[model samples]
Target: MDDDHDDFVGCDTWDEMTAWLGESLPDIPAGVTIDFGPKDLHIGDEPLDDEFDDTDPIEALCAQIVVLKHGRYLVRRSHVVMEATNYLDHDASSATPNLWFDDDPTGDCTAGSIYVDDAGLAAEICVTWLRAESGLPDPTEFGFDISEATHLPGLPGTDAGWSLDDFLRRLGH
Candidate 1:
């Protein structure tokens, strides 16, 4: 994992976070669909009226990512879709606490969220969520785990994993 902790935290955009996830995780099975958008942005095949425009100056931003697992298995096969989320609490003052991932998108499972500005941590939270929805109870299956109440620190972007620089390069930054 990269020892330069500062460099691996807090991603500023969805593109960057998506790039990091693509580079970090193992090859997903074909036909897997990963839908990422603002929280409460979509419902039942229709987009909500208050969709995020990205230009609107907001106090807080919540990004929801849902992965539809077809017929895969960690311990057993699951037919239901799973969702995870990350939030950037720009409105968080010394007194106001940040928002978290608690909504049950599928109306069945309510996964946790990571309240950090780090992109790596956000990606890690998604990974953890996927695992939890994978029917596997073991957290060590992935290498590390984050506390449910204290959502801090995340999966280490190993030496073999792609870095933010890689995403920047793709963007010609």
Candidate 2:
């Protein structure tokens, strides 16, 4: 993994995540406060999809923010991992952070693992994943950029040298 902590300097905390969502997305319906601390966020009266039926309930929450490099624009999404605790142990936990590119003509989705010392670090880790997945125009040319972005203090080593662009290229993108 990259092991560089510099990229995660400014990230939202649990509370800030809630506030940021309120300020960004349209107001959630009544009784749907941006709280994912206790009960999991359910879609409706229906049970979760069968694919997610075996998923572990979330013990923590994180926020997803999408930023466009060339424009002063950003959008936020808060997602609760229903299987976070399965990867957690006494001193740490792992989260699978996913990025949905709604605007990508090719319908690309990016994701990776993030380790957290505690639940409080979830948002920061999520932000790190976002930066790595944004595909921004930077010195590292997206490929080398993401290849050097993974950094979790207490988790197992990740395939940081892995590059999304290369994967896409191999897949004929």
Candidate 2: list runs displaced more than 4 Å.
Answer: 1-15, 18-44, 47-81, 92-110, 116-122, 127-173
lDDT of 2 by residue, 1-173 (tens): 12221121122243443333233322211111111221233434255565665344332233332221121112222233322121122221122233333442211112323322222333344434434444333212111111112336888864434344432343233
Taking all chains together, the TM-score of candidate 2 against the true structure is 0.21
Q: State the lDDT of candidate 1 residue by residue for 1-173, as single tens digits.
A: 11221122333443444455545333322122233222222323333246745343322112233221231211111223233223233222232122453543433233333234333454555544534454444322222111111224785532434343453344344
Best by lDDT: 1
Give the range of the ten consecutive residues with the poorest summed lDDT in model 1: 141-150
Question: Which 10 consecutive residues of model 2 have the lowest summed lDDT?
Answer: 139-148
Model 1 CA deviation exceeding 4 Å by range: 1-19, 22-109, 135-173
